[model samples]
Target: MEKNAPCTTVCPTKALKQDEVTRVVTHSTDLCIGCWACSMVCNYGVIGRQKEARVAVKCDLCPGREIPACVEACPTNALVFLEVKKLSGVKRTEAALKLARGMQGKAL
Candidate 1:
């Protein structure tokens, strides 16, 4: 788990926890206090409020399913599930390509 993650850090009831084996962050509604701190601190803004339950809600990556429903339902395939390292590598490759294209017009 990211030690500096604001959502997890600010959760007063410790409802958010990262599984050591799966490395998935899990939320325990039973422990949640309806404070919305997790939703407020979520970087991706995926967290939401369960209006009926008065508790915070977020994606659990669709446990027991091979692919998350969101990813499967995206018609344009805009959403992708990838490991952090793989995503970082893809970003780095894109940046390098952009740099190379920009340098093509320069004297150097």
Candidate 2:
């Protein structure tokens, strides 16, 4: 949820997405499957299908950490990270929609 993730809205399963062309990272939640496919393919280890969410998830640019472990480990700087201004209209819309969906209650 960096700021401008396009794939978050586009994903049919609501699984994963990069913030934008520039972010070059991904975000995941409890829907991961632990497939390890994302970790295997991406040069930056930007993907991981964990068991919690039963789906794939990735980088998500560690905000609190002073430095990312992956970035420090990278030999070629393939995963340069950046932060964006929170002036996100699309993000607000999507979050609003998600919140509304939550109010509907969980599926039985």
Q: Model 2 over residues 11-77: C-alpha lDDT tens digits?
A: 5545565545555445555544455554555543445555665666665556677678787789997
Best candidate (score: TM-score): 1
Q: TM-score of every model?
A: 0.69, 0.34
Model 1: how far residue 84 lies from native, Å: 1.5
lDDT scores of the candidates, listed in order: 0.83, 0.56
Model 1 CA RMSD to the hidden true structure, in angstroms: 3.0
* Model 2: CA > 4 A from native: 1-3, 13-26, 32-54, 73-79, 82-108
RMSD, each candidate, Å?
Answer: 3.0, 17.2
Worst 10 residues of 2 by lDDT: 79-88
Candidate 1 lDDT trough over 10 residues, lowest sum: 1-10
Evaluate model 2: give its TM-score: 0.34
